[model samples]
Target: MRGIGYSLLAAVGAWAFWPTLRDLAEKWQHDPQYSHGLLVPFFVAYLIHRKREDLKQISAVPSWPLSLLFLSTALGCRATSAIFDFLPLDGLALILVLAGAVSLIQGKEMLKTVAPALGFLLFALPLPYSMERWLSQDLQHLATLASTYLLQAIGQPAINEGNVILIDEIKLGIVEACSGLRMLMTFAAFATGITLLIDRSWATKTVLILSAIPIALIVNVLRISATGLAYVLLREAPERQNMLGFIHDFNGWMMMPVALVLFGIELKVLQWLLVEPEKLERVISFPIRREMPEVPARKAA
Candidate 1:
């Protein structure tokens, strides 16, 4: 009976927000920068699944007041969207309705338990155009400045003007697309997911999350530096163009993997720094029998 009611609530939600979902889907499909939005729903589902054991321990009690509150908020947002023709409001209303459905079925305790994952869903929503543009411009300049200095440090003649890096005769422009904003967003989201899954202290989790910024900057620096080197070495226009194109695409795709590796290193460094020397030695000596516990003589002997 509960399952039936949940299904009916889900059906109603689908009917109410189909247009919003469709619009969001179109954005996810058409916007390359926001393509990662497609995976956020799956990530949310996975997080909830990971908490199933905790969820099973509680009995769901419906809260009429909470449900009504959420429903009213959703209706208000829908009305606002209709008045302003602002589609993002409709999407916001859909999210509110989802919260209301949980309240209707599983109550406020379950909502609290699931709120972090639900909050994460906001990352799936695209930022306002003005904000995105400002961030992208800042990132582009930072990348160009870092790449120019790094290239010159290695004895390459490089100059940066705005977001373009000139190494010898080749000019590499760090456009908005290559501004590393994508990597920053994707890796920050990835870090949040990883931090949730790990059984670590809040401080450690904070470190892991904060480390994404430096990791992203370092990775972007390396990517641009490599581009500079490739341009200098590949003097032929055809060869340089081919190599630059490959480098751009390859580095763009590999940022996430590089972020994972860097985050793992940060965790290891944190452990090494915080743990005692004996514990660290034991970890280093694992499987070598050096730290094995001594056994007492047998009673019969």
Candidate 2:
């Protein structure tokens, strides 16, 4: 009965989260690049289950003032979203959801324990519509330039028009969808999840997450470059423009695999670049302890 009261109160207090969840739906409907949006609730459920053991161990501390602060910030974000709609990154929404969940389950300390993992999950959210448009243009152009240069590098005749690359009379428009940003987003999302799962320090996670972005872009460029080679070297006539159509028709499915391969490369590179945290701690703390004067041991209270 006592447990029931606590659980019921938590449910009632978590009501403030409805707005954020609705906002997520609104965003998902707008410019969805993948079907992963449908999986978000499941993902959240999985995270909760994954941490179920830890949650059982944690004793929640209710702080009304801190919770109200978080609530106000969420409201402020919703209001800011009303006017500008680009006030926060999609990740911030996940943070808000986690905040409410933590308020219901525990508090700052327990929340912090899994903050990196939750923050990493936020990568699954799509980019804001405004930013996505800008990125799409840049990626399209990059794909075009890379494709043209590669064709010419192999001594093939090539002409570039904006994002449209013409080779051996076959034209390939590195269309909006083909810009590879979609693949990049998908790969980066998973990479973030993996990084958080393994690495603990914020610095290491941040570096890995940031690295995911550029690595995705480069892998995308490579995919485009490969497709361009096939179009130019294989096609014998100008009428064979279905190069892209054939490759992406259901070959769009191939992209997930390609992106995953790229993500693996990123994981390897990061693992090599990173020294283990235990080693780092030893390096930093060893000198400090040796240099500082030791205090006498204190009696237990």
Candidate 3:
């Protein structure tokens, strides 16, 4: 009976959210910045699987009030999205509906157990247009500034002018596409997923997630810098244009692996710096023996 209820709920959810899911899939396919969205569902499934035992231990106690509240909000959001033609709102409605379904069927304890996986779904949704544009511009400017400085440091006659870098007579435009926002978003999602899966202290998990930002930024900067170097080095070759194009695309593909290596290094550093509290407690509890007082006097007596 419980399984039948879940199946019916799943059917209703899928039927209602079909359009939203289609739109999300389209965005993931068309937008480079959100390509990582494609992997999010699989990761979420894995997370749920990891928590399956915990979830099984939690007994269902449906909450009528909470379920109604969430479902009503979801319906409102869905209607708003239809009126405004906003996809993000639709995505939000989907999340809320899922939450409502869980509350209705399995209750709060089950929701808490699966909250991280549910929250991870947000990464699959695209940001609002205004926010995405603003982020792109800022990232472009930062990448240009950092890349220019790096080029100068390496003895290249590079000058930053807005989002474009001038190297001698050549121009390297740090356009929206080269802004590194894609890498940042993808890496952040990856880090968060890893943090949720790993058995680590909360502090360690926090640091791991936060560290993704700087690591992503640094990797992006290196990629831009390398591209600039390649441009300079291949300036006079007959195959310069082709070589430059290849290098640019190749560096773009390499960012993730480079970021992963940096992430590993960070994990190692965190391990050295932040000993788990449980481990620390064990160390503190470890018995220490003091040297026994000399028995020479007793022997003499």
Candidate 4:
């Protein structure tokens, strides 16, 4: 009966916040950079499910005080949103409301049990417009500079101004879409989810998450450099004007897989360096064999 009651409260919370969630869904559907948003919820759900047995062991004592605090925070968000016209605040309020509902129904234990999953949901929410633009512009500039340097290193005549790279008089622009921010966001979330699932040390998890930054930057650099080289190769082919467009789309799609491969390599290196040799031996070593000693020589003597 108590479980049913908690479910009802959760249902009520979701129903009340349906409009906000619907709006977020629409944003995720329309935004390419946030396309990964659609996958985040499923991952959160999976994480919660993985913790089911652990959660079941905790008592659901009603946490009225925490519930009140969370409710007030949600209300505050709504009030702030009304005055500031910030849509992200509305999404934040929903998160708080969900947290409050969990606290109210199942108490602190349940809330804590699901906290990481709730935190993961933050990745699905779109960032503030201004912040997203600022970050994107920074990534675009970095990608341009890195690509130009790489091109020059390879003996390709390349010059960059702002986000545009001029190679052999072929101009390649690193637009907002090519900023690699999307890769960073997606891979960061991916790495987080992976760490949560794996039984690894905090240090390993931290390194894994931090590695996403360089991995993303390097992949974006290679992508941009590839585009520059592609332009130089195909510049004379007037009939293949659409070739660059195809290359652009292909590289955009390839970024995630390349990031994943790099991350896998990082994981392997970490395992090699940090994982105990005894564990590896247990996993891969053949059953211990009794080595026949030359002690028989002593008896002969």
Give the alpha-carbon lDDT of every model. 0.83, 0.67, 0.91, 0.86
Pick by TM-score: 1 or 2, better one: 1
Query: TM-score order of candidates, best first?
Result: 3, 4, 1, 2
- Report the lDDT tens digits of candidate 3 across residue range 44-158: 9999998888987999999889999989999999999999999999999999988888898889998888889999999999999999999989988998998889899999999
Candidate 4 regions with alpha-carbon error over 4 angstroms: 1-7, 275-301
Overall local distance difference test of candidate 1: 0.83
Model 2 stretches astray by more than 4 angstroms: 1-34, 82-98, 199-204, 233-244, 279-301
- As a TM-score, model 1 comes out at 0.85
Best by lDDT: 3
What are the clashing pairs of model 4? Answer: none
Q: What stretches of model 1 exceed 4 Å from their correct place?
A: 85-88, 274-301
Q: Which model, 1 or 3, shows the larger lDDT? A: 3
TM-score of each candidate structure, all chains considered together = 0.85, 0.73, 0.96, 0.87
Better of 2 and 3 by lDDT: 3
Candidate 1: residue 48 lDDT (0-100):
92
CA lDDT, candidate 1, residue 110: 93
lDDT of 4 by residue, 42-149 (tens): 988999999999998998798999999999999999889778877789888988888988898789989998999998888888889999999999998988898999
By lDDT: ranked, best first? 3, 4, 1, 2
Give the local distance difference test score of model 3: 0.91
Clash counts for the predictions, in order? 0, 0, 0, 0
